[model samples]
Target: MAVVNKNQLLDFLENRVEGHLQEAIRVFQNERAEILLQPAPDGGWSIAQCLEHLNGYGKFYLPQINKGLNQANRSSNSEIFKGSWLGTYFTRMMEPTTGTKKYKAFKNHIPAPDLDAPAVVAEFIHQQEELIVYLKQARQENVDAIKIPLSISKWVKLKLGDVFQFLIAHNERHLLQAKRNLKNLEVADKS
Candidate 1:
Protein backbone atom coordinates (compact mmCIF):
# COMPACT_ATOMS: atom_id res chain seq x y z
CA MET A 1 0.00 0.00 0.00
CA ALA A 2 1.10 3.56 -0.62
CA VAL A 3 2.50 5.46 2.34
CA VAL A 4 -0.32 7.60 3.75
CA ASN A 5 0.27 11.31 3.33
CA LYS A 6 0.27 13.08 6.69
CA ASN A 7 -1.51 16.28 5.74
CA GLN A 8 -3.79 14.29 3.50
CA LEU A 9 -4.63 11.92 6.31
CA LEU A 10 -5.40 14.82 8.61
CA ASP A 11 -7.53 16.40 5.95
CA PHE A 12 -9.21 13.10 5.22
CA LEU A 13 -10.15 12.56 8.83
CA GLU A 14 -11.15 16.14 9.37
CA ASN A 15 -13.59 15.77 6.53
CA ARG A 16 -14.69 12.19 7.17
CA VAL A 17 -14.38 10.94 10.78
CA GLU A 18 -17.75 12.28 11.84
CA GLY A 19 -19.40 10.58 8.90
CA HIS A 20 -17.67 7.31 9.65
CA LEU A 21 -18.68 7.57 13.29
CA GLN A 22 -22.28 8.19 12.44
CA GLU A 23 -22.38 5.47 9.82
CA ALA A 24 -20.92 2.97 12.26
CA ILE A 25 -23.46 3.82 14.93
CA ARG A 26 -26.33 3.54 12.50
CA VAL A 27 -25.33 0.08 11.29
CA PHE A 28 -24.74 -1.21 14.81
CA GLN A 29 -27.95 0.04 16.34
CA ASN A 30 -29.84 -3.11 15.31
CA GLU A 31 -27.50 -6.08 15.56
CA ARG A 32 -28.76 -9.51 16.73
CA ALA A 33 -26.00 -11.45 18.48
CA GLU A 34 -27.24 -14.97 17.83
CA ILE A 35 -27.60 -14.34 14.13
CA LEU A 36 -24.23 -12.62 14.16
CA LEU A 37 -22.32 -15.42 15.87
CA GLN A 38 -23.49 -18.22 13.60
CA PRO A 39 -20.63 -19.58 11.50
CA ALA A 40 -20.23 -18.99 7.77
CA PRO A 41 -19.80 -21.78 5.20
CA ASP A 42 -16.26 -20.72 4.23
CA GLY A 43 -15.29 -21.37 7.87
CA GLY A 44 -14.75 -17.69 8.62
CA TRP A 45 -15.67 -15.79 11.78
CA SER A 46 -19.18 -14.99 12.83
CA ILE A 47 -20.07 -11.31 12.84
CA ALA A 48 -19.98 -11.09 16.61
CA GLN A 49 -16.59 -12.72 16.82
CA CYS A 50 -15.08 -10.63 14.07
CA LEU A 51 -16.10 -7.37 15.70
CA GLU A 52 -14.64 -8.44 19.00
CA HIS A 53 -11.49 -9.68 17.35
CA LEU A 54 -10.99 -6.48 15.35
CA ASN A 55 -11.11 -4.30 18.43
CA GLY A 56 -8.29 -6.40 19.85
CA TYR A 57 -5.81 -3.83 18.55
CA GLY A 58 -7.12 -0.99 20.66
CA LYS A 59 -5.14 -2.46 23.53
CA PHE A 60 -2.03 -1.45 21.62
CA TYR A 61 -3.02 1.38 19.24
CA LEU A 62 -4.91 3.51 21.74
CA PRO A 63 -1.93 3.75 24.06
CA GLN A 64 0.56 4.07 21.21
CA ILE A 65 -1.38 6.95 19.65
CA ASN A 66 -1.24 8.76 22.96
CA LYS A 67 2.50 8.10 23.23
CA GLY A 68 3.12 9.40 19.72
CA LEU A 69 1.23 12.57 20.53
CA ASN A 70 3.16 13.10 23.77
CA GLN A 71 6.59 12.18 22.43
CA ALA A 72 9.04 14.28 20.46
CA ASN A 73 8.79 14.89 16.74
CA ARG A 74 10.56 12.84 14.11
CA SER A 75 8.46 14.07 11.21
CA SER A 76 10.85 13.08 8.50
CA ASN A 77 10.37 9.45 7.43
CA SER A 78 8.16 8.64 10.36
CA GLU A 79 5.67 6.76 8.19
CA ILE A 80 8.47 5.23 6.19
CA PHE A 81 10.35 3.92 9.20
CA LYS A 82 10.06 0.15 9.61
CA GLY A 83 7.02 -0.73 11.72
CA SER A 84 7.09 -2.85 14.85
CA TRP A 85 5.50 -6.20 14.03
CA LEU A 86 2.47 -5.58 11.80
CA GLY A 87 4.16 -2.80 9.91
CA THR A 88 7.39 -4.69 9.39
CA TYR A 89 5.41 -7.69 8.22
CA PHE A 90 3.41 -5.58 5.82
CA THR A 91 6.51 -3.80 4.56
CA ARG A 92 8.50 -6.92 3.88
CA MET A 93 5.57 -8.70 2.33
CA MET A 94 4.44 -5.76 0.24
CA GLU A 95 7.89 -4.39 -0.57
CA PRO A 96 8.11 -2.01 -3.50
CA THR A 97 11.25 -3.85 -4.50
CA THR A 98 9.40 -7.16 -4.53
CA GLY A 99 6.53 -8.29 -6.73
CA THR A 100 3.05 -8.21 -5.18
CA LYS A 101 2.36 -10.58 -2.33
CA LYS A 102 -0.97 -11.73 -0.93
CA TYR A 103 -2.09 -9.82 2.16
CA LYS A 104 -2.07 -12.38 4.92
CA ALA A 105 -5.30 -12.60 6.90
CA PHE A 106 -6.32 -14.11 10.23
CA LYS A 107 -9.01 -13.95 12.95
CA ASN A 108 -9.99 -15.03 16.49
CA HIS A 109 -13.02 -15.01 18.79
CA ILE A 110 -12.99 -14.26 22.51
CA PRO A 111 -15.05 -16.82 24.39
CA ALA A 112 -18.30 -15.29 25.47
CA PRO A 113 -21.00 -17.57 24.12
CA ASP A 114 -23.52 -16.17 26.57
CA LEU A 115 -22.82 -12.51 25.90
CA ASP A 116 -25.64 -10.63 24.21
CA ALA A 117 -25.21 -8.91 20.82
CA PRO A 118 -25.90 -5.42 22.11
CA ALA A 119 -23.19 -5.81 24.72
CA VAL A 120 -20.65 -6.71 22.09
CA VAL A 121 -21.93 -3.90 19.91
CA ALA A 122 -21.64 -1.61 22.90
CA GLU A 123 -18.01 -2.55 23.32
CA PHE A 124 -17.35 -1.89 19.64
CA ILE A 125 -19.10 1.46 19.92
CA HIS A 126 -16.96 2.29 22.90
CA GLN A 127 -13.85 1.49 20.91
CA GLN A 128 -14.94 3.63 17.97
CA GLU A 129 -15.72 6.48 20.35
CA GLU A 130 -12.28 6.21 21.89
CA LEU A 131 -10.75 6.24 18.42
CA ILE A 132 -12.78 9.31 17.46
CA VAL A 133 -11.55 11.11 20.57
CA TYR A 134 -7.94 10.16 19.89
CA LEU A 135 -8.02 11.11 16.24
CA LYS A 136 -9.76 14.39 16.97
CA GLN A 137 -7.25 15.26 19.65
CA ALA A 138 -4.22 14.48 17.50
CA ARG A 139 -2.30 17.27 15.79
CA GLN A 140 -1.09 17.19 12.21
CA GLU A 141 2.45 17.67 13.43
CA ASN A 142 2.11 14.69 15.72
CA VAL A 143 0.61 12.69 12.89
CA ASP A 144 3.78 13.25 10.88
CA ALA A 145 6.17 12.82 13.79
CA ILE A 146 5.17 9.83 15.84
CA LYS A 147 5.76 6.19 14.93
CA ILE A 148 4.86 3.31 17.19
CA PRO A 149 5.37 -0.41 16.88
CA LEU A 150 2.32 -1.96 15.23
CA SER A 151 2.45 -4.83 17.65
CA ILE A 152 4.56 -6.64 20.21
CA SER A 153 4.70 -9.07 17.32
CA LYS A 154 7.12 -6.51 15.81
CA TRP A 155 5.12 -6.69 12.57
CA VAL A 156 6.24 -3.09 12.10
CA LYS A 157 6.06 0.45 13.39
CA LEU A 158 3.32 2.76 12.13
CA LYS A 159 2.69 6.50 12.01
CA LEU A 160 0.37 7.48 14.81
CA GLY A 161 -2.07 8.81 12.23
CA ASP A 162 -1.78 5.62 10.27
CA VAL A 163 -2.88 3.92 13.47
CA PHE A 164 -6.35 5.32 12.90
CA GLN A 165 -6.18 4.58 9.22
CA PHE A 166 -5.29 0.99 9.88
CA LEU A 167 -8.09 0.91 12.40
CA ILE A 168 -10.69 2.16 9.93
CA ALA A 169 -9.47 -0.11 7.19
CA HIS A 170 -9.25 -3.08 9.48
CA ASN A 171 -12.73 -2.49 10.86
CA GLU A 172 -14.18 -2.23 7.39
CA ARG A 173 -12.46 -5.41 6.38
CA HIS A 174 -14.21 -7.23 9.22
CA LEU A 175 -17.44 -5.41 8.66
CA LEU A 176 -17.40 -6.87 5.17
CA GLN A 177 -16.81 -10.21 6.81
CA ALA A 178 -19.79 -9.58 9.06
CA LYS A 179 -21.90 -8.72 6.04
CA ARG A 180 -20.76 -11.95 4.46
CA ASN A 181 -21.67 -13.67 7.70
CA LEU A 182 -25.13 -12.26 7.23
CA LYS A 183 -25.30 -13.87 3.82
CA ASN A 184 -24.29 -17.15 5.35
CA LEU A 185 -26.99 -16.68 7.92
CA GLU A 186 -29.40 -16.19 5.06
CA VAL A 187 -28.24 -19.31 3.27
CA ALA A 188 -28.65 -21.32 6.43
CA ASP A 189 -32.10 -19.89 6.92
CA LYS A 190 -33.02 -21.12 3.43
CA SER A 191 -31.56 -24.55 4.08
Candidate 2:
Protein backbone atom coordinates (compact mmCIF):
# COMPACT_ATOMS: atom_id res chain seq x y z
CA MET A 1 0.00 0.00 0.00
CA ALA A 2 1.19 3.50 -0.85
CA VAL A 3 1.91 5.54 2.23
CA VAL A 4 0.37 8.98 1.91
CA ASN A 5 2.07 11.98 3.49
CA LYS A 6 1.06 12.21 7.14
CA ASN A 7 0.13 15.89 6.99
CA GLN A 8 -1.82 15.37 3.78
CA LEU A 9 -3.62 12.38 5.19
CA LEU A 10 -4.29 14.23 8.41
CA ASP A 11 -5.91 17.05 6.43
CA PHE A 12 -7.94 14.52 4.49
CA LEU A 13 -9.09 13.02 7.77
CA GLU A 14 -10.08 16.44 9.18
CA ASN A 15 -12.69 16.85 6.45
CA ARG A 16 -13.53 13.38 5.18
CA VAL A 17 -13.51 11.39 8.39
CA GLU A 18 -15.30 14.19 10.23
CA GLY A 19 -18.02 14.45 7.61
CA HIS A 20 -18.58 10.71 7.55
CA LEU A 21 -18.45 10.62 11.30
CA GLN A 22 -21.07 13.36 11.61
CA GLU A 23 -23.40 11.53 9.26
CA ALA A 24 -22.85 8.30 11.15
CA ILE A 25 -23.62 10.03 14.44
CA ARG A 26 -26.84 11.31 12.94
CA VAL A 27 -27.72 7.74 12.06
CA PHE A 28 -27.01 6.64 15.61
CA GLN A 29 -29.17 9.39 17.06
CA ASN A 30 -32.03 8.24 14.86
CA GLU A 31 -31.60 4.50 15.33
CA ARG A 32 -33.61 2.24 17.59
CA ALA A 33 -31.90 -0.33 19.80
CA GLU A 34 -33.56 -3.29 18.15
CA ILE A 35 -31.79 -2.39 14.95
CA LEU A 36 -28.44 -1.41 16.43
CA LEU A 37 -27.40 -4.57 18.21
CA GLN A 38 -28.23 -7.20 15.63
CA PRO A 39 -26.72 -7.84 12.24
CA ALA A 40 -28.78 -8.00 9.06
CA PRO A 41 -29.35 -11.25 7.17
CA ASP A 42 -26.49 -10.19 4.97
CA GLY A 43 -24.22 -9.91 8.00
CA GLY A 44 -23.87 -6.20 8.46
CA TRP A 45 -23.81 -3.93 11.49
CA SER A 46 -26.39 -1.34 12.48
CA ILE A 47 -25.54 2.34 12.49
CA ALA A 48 -25.28 2.78 16.22
CA GLN A 49 -22.98 -0.18 16.66
CA CYS A 50 -20.74 0.98 13.87
CA LEU A 51 -20.24 4.37 15.52
CA GLU A 52 -19.31 2.54 18.66
CA HIS A 53 -16.63 0.51 16.91
CA LEU A 54 -15.35 3.25 14.56
CA ASN A 55 -14.73 5.54 17.45
CA GLY A 56 -13.59 2.50 19.42
CA TYR A 57 -10.16 2.10 17.85
CA GLY A 58 -9.69 5.69 16.66
CA LYS A 59 -10.03 6.66 20.27
CA PHE A 60 -7.21 4.26 21.08
CA TYR A 61 -4.69 4.91 18.28
CA LEU A 62 -5.12 8.69 18.07
CA PRO A 63 -3.22 9.18 21.31
CA GLN A 64 -0.38 6.81 20.54
CA ILE A 65 -0.05 8.00 16.98
CA ASN A 66 -0.03 11.58 18.24
CA LYS A 67 2.62 10.82 20.82
CA GLY A 68 4.87 9.31 18.20
CA LEU A 69 4.26 12.19 15.80
CA ASN A 70 4.76 14.90 18.39
CA GLN A 71 8.04 13.54 19.68
CA ALA A 72 9.59 13.31 16.25
CA ASN A 73 13.34 14.01 16.38
CA ARG A 74 13.04 15.88 19.66
CA SER A 75 13.71 13.10 22.15
CA SER A 76 14.82 9.53 21.99
CA ASN A 77 12.10 8.69 24.45
CA SER A 78 8.73 9.28 22.78
CA GLU A 79 5.68 8.58 24.93
CA ILE A 80 4.66 5.87 22.50
CA PHE A 81 8.12 4.29 22.43
CA LYS A 82 5.91 1.65 23.85
CA GLY A 83 2.26 1.88 22.83
CA SER A 84 -0.74 2.04 25.18
CA TRP A 85 -2.84 -0.82 26.50
CA LEU A 86 -5.91 0.33 24.64
CA GLY A 87 -4.38 -0.86 21.39
CA THR A 88 -3.50 -4.18 22.94
CA TYR A 89 -6.95 -4.63 24.44
CA PHE A 90 -8.63 -3.76 21.18
CA THR A 91 -6.85 -6.55 19.32
CA ARG A 92 -7.59 -9.30 21.79
CA MET A 93 -11.27 -8.39 21.85
CA MET A 94 -11.52 -8.20 18.10
CA GLU A 95 -9.85 -11.58 17.68
CA PRO A 96 -13.04 -13.65 18.06
CA THR A 97 -14.96 -11.20 15.91
CA THR A 98 -12.57 -10.99 12.95
CA GLY A 99 -11.17 -14.52 13.45
CA THR A 100 -7.56 -13.65 12.78
CA LYS A 101 -4.80 -14.61 15.16
CA LYS A 102 -2.64 -11.58 14.32
CA TYR A 103 -2.66 -8.15 12.76
CA LYS A 104 -0.94 -7.26 9.49
CA ALA A 105 -0.93 -3.48 9.86
CA PHE A 106 0.16 -3.09 13.44
CA LYS A 107 2.83 -5.09 15.21
CA ASN A 108 0.84 -4.52 18.36
CA HIS A 109 -2.87 -5.23 17.99
CA ILE A 110 -5.80 -2.98 18.91
CA PRO A 111 -9.00 -4.73 20.02
CA ALA A 112 -12.71 -4.13 19.72
CA PRO A 113 -14.80 -4.40 22.86
CA ASP A 114 -16.41 -7.81 22.78
CA LEU A 115 -19.52 -6.50 24.46
CA ASP A 116 -20.37 -3.01 23.07
CA ALA A 117 -19.22 0.29 21.57
CA PRO A 118 -20.18 2.98 24.12
CA ALA A 119 -17.80 1.83 26.83
CA VAL A 120 -14.84 1.33 24.53
CA VAL A 121 -15.33 4.30 22.22
CA ALA A 122 -15.71 6.70 25.16
CA GLU A 123 -12.22 5.86 26.36
CA PHE A 124 -10.96 5.96 22.82
CA ILE A 125 -12.31 9.49 22.28
CA HIS A 126 -11.01 10.92 25.53
CA GLN A 127 -7.44 9.91 24.71
CA GLN A 128 -7.98 11.07 21.16
CA GLU A 129 -8.85 14.53 22.44
CA GLU A 130 -5.71 14.52 24.54
CA LEU A 131 -3.69 13.52 21.48
CA ILE A 132 -5.29 16.24 19.40
CA VAL A 133 -4.15 18.86 21.86
CA TYR A 134 -0.65 18.62 20.37
CA LEU A 135 -1.32 17.44 16.83
CA LYS A 136 0.46 20.42 15.31
CA GLN A 137 3.71 18.80 16.33
CA ALA A 138 2.95 15.84 14.05
CA ARG A 139 4.77 15.61 10.76
CA GLN A 140 4.95 12.96 8.01
CA GLU A 141 8.71 12.61 7.92
CA ASN A 142 8.93 12.20 11.64
CA VAL A 143 5.98 9.84 12.07
CA ASP A 144 7.39 7.59 9.37
CA ALA A 145 10.38 6.94 11.54
CA ILE A 146 8.27 5.58 14.36
CA LYS A 147 8.27 1.79 14.60
CA ILE A 148 7.59 -1.01 17.00
CA PRO A 149 8.32 -4.72 16.91
CA LEU A 150 5.27 -6.81 16.15
CA SER A 151 3.90 -8.74 19.06
CA ILE A 152 2.58 -11.34 16.64
CA SER A 153 5.52 -11.12 14.30
CA LYS A 154 8.68 -10.33 16.19
CA TRP A 155 10.66 -9.84 13.01
CA VAL A 156 8.33 -7.16 11.67
CA LYS A 157 8.10 -3.50 12.60
CA LEU A 158 4.82 -1.68 12.13
CA LYS A 159 5.21 1.86 10.88
CA LEU A 160 3.31 4.69 12.51
CA GLY A 161 1.64 5.90 9.29
CA ASP A 162 0.23 2.45 8.52
CA VAL A 163 -1.47 2.45 11.89
CA PHE A 164 -3.01 5.81 11.01
CA GLN A 165 -4.25 4.45 7.69
CA PHE A 166 -5.65 1.41 9.44
CA LEU A 167 -7.66 3.66 11.73
CA ILE A 168 -9.19 5.45 8.74
CA ALA A 169 -9.92 2.17 7.02
CA HIS A 170 -11.33 0.73 10.20
CA ASN A 171 -13.77 3.65 10.41
CA GLU A 172 -14.81 3.24 6.81
CA ARG A 173 -15.26 -0.48 7.31
CA HIS A 174 -17.72 0.09 10.14
CA LEU A 175 -19.42 2.92 8.25
CA LEU A 176 -20.06 0.55 5.39
CA GLN A 177 -21.27 -2.00 7.88
CA ALA A 178 -23.75 0.57 9.16
CA LYS A 179 -24.95 1.36 5.66
CA ARG A 180 -25.42 -2.29 4.90
CA ASN A 181 -27.25 -2.67 8.18
CA LEU A 182 -29.52 0.16 7.26
CA LYS A 183 -30.38 -1.60 4.07
CA ASN A 184 -31.02 -4.78 6.02
CA LEU A 185 -33.31 -2.90 8.36
CA GLU A 186 -35.25 -1.66 5.37
CA VAL A 187 -35.61 -5.17 4.03
CA ALA A 188 -36.75 -6.48 7.38
CA ASP A 189 -39.29 -3.68 7.59
CA LYS A 190 -40.53 -4.48 4.12
CA SER A 191 -40.90 -8.14 4.95
Per-residue accuracy of model 2 over 56-87 as CA lDDT, tens digit each: 45545565565566556654423322223443
Model 1 weakest lDDT span, ten residues long: 74-83
Q: Would you estimate the TM-scores of all the predictions?
A: 0.69, 0.58
lDDT, candidate 1, 37-101, per-residue tens: 67666766667676676666666577777777667553543323222455434434433234144
The deviation in Å at residue 118 for candidate 1 is 2.3
The lowest-lDDT stretch of 10 consecutive residues in candidate 2 is 75-84
Off by over 4 Å in 1: 1-5, 13-20, 72-116, 154-156
lDDT of each: 0.60, 0.50
Candidate 1's TM-score reads: 0.69
